[model samples]
Target: MGDDVDRIKSRLDVVDIVGDYVKLTRSGRNYKGLCPFHEEKTPSFYVSQERQSWHCFGCGKGGDIFSFVMEKEGLSFPEALSLLARRAGIEIESYRRSDGSGKKTLFDIMEEACSLFRTCMNGDQGSVPRGYLDRRMIPPQVRSSFELGWSPPSWSFMVQYIKKKGISLKDAERCGLVLRGNRGPYDRFRGRVIFPIRDITGRLVAFGGRIVDGDGAKYLNSPETEIYSKRRTLYLIDKAKGAIRNGGHSIIVEGYMDALRLHMEGYPQTVATLGTALTEDQATILKRLADEVFICYDADQAGQTAAIRGMYVLQQAGLSVKVVALPEGKDPDDLLRSDGGKARFNDCLKEALPLVEHHIKLLSPAIKDDRTRKSAIHDLLEGLSNIDVTDVSPYLPSLAALLGIRDFEVLDALERVRSKRRKTDRSFDTEEIPSSLPDEGQQSQEMPPLPEIALISLLWSECDLRRKCDTREVVELLSDPRLKLMASSIMMGESPSSLEKRWLEMGETFQLRVLARGGAYLDEFTQNSDWKWRHFCHLLYRQKGQMRYNELRVKMLKGEATTREIREMEDLRQKLVSQKGS
Candidate 1:
């Protein structure tokens, strides 16, 4: 580990940082959330509030806050550290050693370059870039908002401009805007409308330019420099972050206009990859806001292929990938210009198909030949099997019918292929059970889905259930151990707040033990208005008044009776009834 790493880790708490990114619900002593760096339906991301660290069981991403930022933001070690250090309010002493030697960070240089570029765009002394903006139909307000600028057309423009400002050509070249040429130096983004790319903190670190004439590339971006990686950025994530969080989804488009158009048209959460295929780095950044993402790329062949690759990439990251199948030959920008664009886009979202369905569609067309047709069917089934179909699984039979499979045997065959493919592809870890108790019951009966656990946990933890029942007396008459545990857990946790923390830290293993003792179901109890566990407990306390003695008195004379002990039987019934009353 670097000294900086140790320093930041010592000062910043990972739990606090990770919690800012993902909403963590307390599970025991730890908090659980959907991993922001991976695609997962249920949360496997665990953050230890006690230890101030996080570990994602799904993707195996684990670390302190600095590590999390570095990995997820695609920032360098120093960059991540600088961010954390600033967050922790760490102050630095001015370095003025006689032999003076401290290096300026990439961020520092990028800052200078951004200012220079902005100056050039905003009528830097003489020449103005406003003419360029006017020609493009981009409103001046839009240009200024996005920090549109220009680099002088002359080769010596940047070299001369920055040299006068104490920035060397060597440093400028490293920032990806200057290159060595026979006639001294040249501006990399000469004669173009510059679109400065910035981080979430508004640090201008790179630039993307559009050529004014038939010039070179349509879009020329800064090469990978110390501070900027083209593949690691999206065009306007900083602006879209709040929108993404509010919408609970992010729509990734293909170009700058697509993003701007969407945002300008009220879909503020839309974003675009910076002239490259979606990178895990970018996906990780988006993961901070939403678990579900819609890829609304262009509908060309290249776009379709890009969609497929992005789907797999994000799926591996644990995000649910939905492909917004746009109309043929249209991009988000193209469609947004249509008369009914918004409605069309929404219809697309409503019709958005899962990755597996898209995969099936891709394979369906090629299944013309008999042998290849069989292969295609198996392939489609394999893809289908990966889907957690409990939610959408019912569609399988309807889809089978659509496929014209009327016979049960043909349907069974497809299902079999699906099962086989699932077994082959999944290779995911089987959770290990250390004891016989959990294993025995699991072996005997199919274990309930963990999604149900998530649903129950949400309900049990947050909902005010008093509105559900009629009265305290009726609730007290309810019998079910699981329901009672739910009642107790909620009521007990409500008292101290520390009890909630203690409950959070308990491991899943212990939780499973509690669940196994019939505490998994919530059918055991009921409640009504003004109903609280304490209130119910008060009811139970008073109601247990009579039934305790009759059964015990009979049990005393019941002998150490055999399995057929009538007294013991009566006692058990009375005991159960007493438990119910409570």
Candidate 2:
């Protein structure tokens, strides 16, 4: 197992694995990017190529490639090991327990189902599916690339095929590929063209079947299984992620055909929500890839509603959202099939309205009466308040003018909404105790000076420089308990060569503070390591003097200070005073 891990690590680069998920830029000896684990305005995440590690100063989630993948993909260590090993082309030694194999069983079944669907689509029984595709104007190359498939109209056909392949009937049912009936098991998809849905890593996990010659519902999707989640999965993300990264934006469509049509028309940065409302999971995935999103749903009421909801979700996830308005009564598929379709589509995309503007237009028609206009304005204000916008100055004036209110009034309304949300959010807290409040013993004490924060960041980040300083005394002087704990661990020789590994072992509070304030001494340290070392020494001694003075003052208050203690305290206080004057 260790050998497989070593081989995988040797083949894979930390930058390569993380860069695929984030847009990292070179910074000094490391790489920096906006942290993917949380929403932040500035870049606080750093990746060190030399150490082969990554850390986020903002959220404080850092680790090796294995831990990073495990957190990002929500997999266990063993699962991440298997996944990364496969990606690195290192076959795993199968000495594991049966539970690990059980987890991959459903994924294997899903893959086999996709293979069967593809084989059946290319055979003689695929005539109907082929005719449907021909009518839809999908070329041979597009069909082959997407692996479009067909399922024949017959009960027990797929079940028998899986049984013949030595797959258990229970396992097939577990994957939602077949349903057990009174007589026997039957395929869930029949007489439909299959659109295989893969995860972001291109692993087949589910299917969306559109009926071609049936009297039932027009569309059907595989039931939620261990390997497939409708809310978390976005169709074609595996293929679209690269294009999205290159384009610096993502275009979300409504259906599978709409997404496929956009790709066919040279817009490969498009994905579909697979006929569901936009979900937080999907929005989060999009936000990690690009900062901007364009919603190109159909031009009907339902589509417009979905676009508005999606815009809200994306904006809440800190994405810059725009709404592309298609011609009346036309979807992306319909528009792409029309005359000069690609040109018209490009024009629409170029004219896509910002989400806020599009939302105003959407509500304009209902603002005829005073009551309706007031309600519309209220809704718009509520939406604006929910947005994770950095500079509301540019938006506030326009919003005030639109509502015929003063700018300050608009600000007040927004603050009111936000304040109420904060209160409500706090009310729903499930933690046994409030965390942000200081401890009872700390109520009378002030926090350590800000220079201590800078010193901590410096020692934690710079290795060679930290080796020159008195790390033990510095740890003892830290007032913040979390920082003290982290520094103490380092002082006790629990340091890992990889900074990311060290960060992962630190408490969450410590990690966040490091990311938020750790780089305070970066400029000074880089400009002159000697000056930084002297600066830390000066600050550490000053803190020590202040602590001693405080201790003497308390003893004096209790009338228990001896003459020698009083004289020493006075000397320490004078030294601090002279240093401050200098």
Candidate 3:
């Protein structure tokens, strides 16, 4: 496996691989491009040919080719390896166990099931599904491209077919293709038109089945399996990725057919959530592909409620979101099927409402009674407060008018909600603060001393200085636990670029910290002599020892320190005195 990975890496150049996703221009020794991982206008993302690595100074994301692909395509390490191996024309040795939990094998099973379903749809038994398609005016090309299929009504048919194909019954069950009964195994999907659910890389992972003739649920989807996670998977994302990127936006729909019809009707940048509500994971996937998202859900009350949840998810993911409310009693599929529906839908897209506005507009109908209206207005304002938008003040007048409330009342409500959130929301970044400091209500903790900050910043920016510095020692000198963990990772031989990427994954807070403060002291430390660096290190060690001594004294004063801790504090005090004398 290592040899295979090495072979794949040797065949695929980092610049070329990254260039496929981001346009790169030569900047001295490295290539530079706007980061695809974040919304940046300037080309702060650099590709270093010398190291075969890429890093974004603005967003702090940096990594080797595998990490890059994993972050860019949102795949696990194994998945990225498989994708790159396939791209480089290298085959990976099966990393699967004998019991068959390997994703690759599961993917193969799903693909085979899809093929069987398609064949069954095209066979003599496909008349009902084919007729339904025809009556819906679905073109042949759409059917072919989407690989739409049908499952026979008989439960034993798929079992026999799998047996004929020599597929494992256990594997079939793992893929949710069949269910084992007391008598025998039966097909999970029966008398239904099948739509295969694939990941963004076009790997078959699951299926969504719509009933053609049945008494059970009208639609059923494959249960969550090892290979398929509905929250992270969107229908047609594999086909819609390019169009989504090209259009700089994505159109989110409610149903598979709605997405398919929109794509056929000249809107290729559309996807569906497979009947699940929009999730943070799905929103994140879309945000990576596009900056804006327009939700075109059914215009009924249920759809409106769903649209609100979807909007909140997308907005919280930092993508600009809009809602396209279709005419009452219609969906994207219905609209596309009607005369001039395409033009009307296009107009609707143009007139899509900003998320907050749409939420208020949809909620206004519940204003029949004063108490109900006030409650709805309160919910609306609370939601608005949570949005990361900078200037909700501009929308307040409109919101006030919609709620039939005074402008001052709206402004006061916004202020109170925002203030409450600010007080209560302790973001992940807050965890990085020094443990010695009191929590939120106390005096603001000062930044770590300049010398300590300078030393860390220097280690991050200068390769030579970093190699000379004992990173484990540096980790001990830092007061912040997050910073200590970061330094310890470097000491463990992980590259600073890789750590930067990990910090980016931590969230926007760390990224901003790195951009604003982590690299700021680089010049000061880099230009200084080796002795000055050593002197700063001594100072850091002394300061940390004193801090430890003080903490132990506090514990002793509170009668919380053990006998061992008291002795350790005395030893630290002596060490600090000796160090001061030196």
Candidate 4:
């Protein structure tokens, strides 16, 4: 695999690969071009041909050819490797065989399942499902392009199919295609219209089955498995990502059908959540793909609530959010299907309200009703407090008008709401300590000091520091479990970019936060010798000791401290004091 990578790198020049995506001109030994990752007027993106690296000064993104492909294409490392290998005309069939994780096997199983479903959809068994699609106005090309399929109404059909294919029933079960019953393994998607679900990298991972005519749930999705996580997967993202990048925004809907309809109706940048609220993980995924998101959910109360919750989550992830107001009780599908619906939908997109304004619009009726006025005002203030102040500030006058309150009063109310929420979050019971030690959950909840984040970032950025630092010692000093895992991985020779990719795959955004917060201290840590790094480690140890000391002191105050705990508390206090003195 190493030799394969070297061969590919040796064949593909970074300048040539990047120039295909970015327009670059020779600037001395390097090429400069507008960054494809972020919006920049000047050409801050520089490609160094000599070093085979590229960096964007605007976004602080810098990496080699593989990293560039991964970022630009929103692909996983394996996908990027396959893409670049193919481009470089280097065969890596051996590399795929070397994967011991069984991911490749799972992927192959999913592909087989998809093929089986598609065959069933086109076969005689698919008559009812095909009729249902016709009624829904879905064209044959769209259905075929989306790989729509059908599962025959038979308990043993898929079981027999898998057996004949020589595929393990266990592998099928792992892919969420088969389930073990009291009798034997049965098909999970019997008598249903199947929607093949692919990951962002265009790999089939799971399926969503919609009952055409049956005594089962209206919709059923593949269960969480080794390769498929509903929160991390978006419907049609494989098809929509390119359009999302070109359009500079994304349109989010609530269901698979809605996404399909939007895509078929010339909205190629649309993706659907897996019939759930927009999770922070999903928001993080979008945050990487686009700067803004427009959510077009059903117009019912439940859908509006979902839209509001999703807007807050997306905003928290730093993406500008807008709510597409569909007509009452109409989803994107229904709205698009109505007379003159396409133009109306386009108008809705044009007139989508920003997050705060949309929240205000939702509360308008409640505020107008005298009986619900106070509650609506309170709700509005609480919701506003969750949003960034700058985002909410511009709408204060409008909100005040709706509430029939003074602008300053509205601002004061918002501040009070924010203060109350902060106090509630910080309110911890110190008197209820049973032991001097904090529980694992409590320890995990304790936010690590900013300096610790900076230290981890520095270690990740500088390979020499990773080699110098003891893995166990660094892991012990880290307070956050996530950081501990990251430190261990770094010490085990995982590259920072690889770790970042892993975190992104798992839908974790803490790495991004760590890098952003730790950027300020990177230069400081680099300029100072190893002493600064050692000092940060000492500070972490002292911070841990101080927390323990505080816990023990609380227990002592409550008269619950044992002799052992008392001795340990004293030792911690002394160590912390000595460290402080040093």
- The number of the candidate with the highest TM-score is 2
Q: Give the C-alpha miss distance for residue 283 in model 1, angstroms.
A: 2.6
Residue 204 of candidate 1: its Cα lDDT?
58
TM-score: model 3 vs. ground truth: 0.65
Q: Native-vs-model 1 lDDT?
A: 0.62
Stretches of model 2 off by over 4 angstroms after superposition: 1-13, 19-25, 33-45, 48-101, 182-184, 369-379, 388-436, 439-582
Tens-digit lDDT track of model 4 for 1-582 = 677778989998987677546656666567777788886544567899999999986689999999998898665677678767756767786234354336667777787888888998898888899999999999889889999999999998989999999988888888888999899899888889999988765667889999988699999999999889998888998788768766779999988899999998999999998977788888876776668999888888655854576578789888989888888878999989999999999999999998888888888898899998888777777777777544665676787788777765675577668666766776673333466777866554334566678688778777788777788888888877778877887789877788789889998766676676466445434456477687787778777787888688667655799999988976775576556556
Off by over 4 Å in 4: 1-101, 423-582
Q: How does candidate 4 fare on TM-score?
A: 0.63
- Best of the two (3, 4) by lDDT: 4
10 residues in a row with least lDDT, candidate 1: 516-525
Number of the candidate with higher TM-score, 1 or 2: 2
lDDT digits (tens) for residues 441-533 of candidate 2: 554233244566667666666677557657667777777776676666555555435544656676334454454554643552465656765
Off by over 4 Å in 3: 1-101, 404-408, 411-582
- What is the Cα-based lDDT of residue 518 in candidate 1? 26
Question: TM per model?
Answer: 0.56, 0.69, 0.65, 0.63
**Model 3: lDDT to the true structure:** 0.77
lDDT of candidate 2 at residue 563, scale 0 to 100: 91
343-420 per-residue lDDT for model 3 (tens digits) = 999899999998877877777776546768777766677778767423354466677777677754664566577666
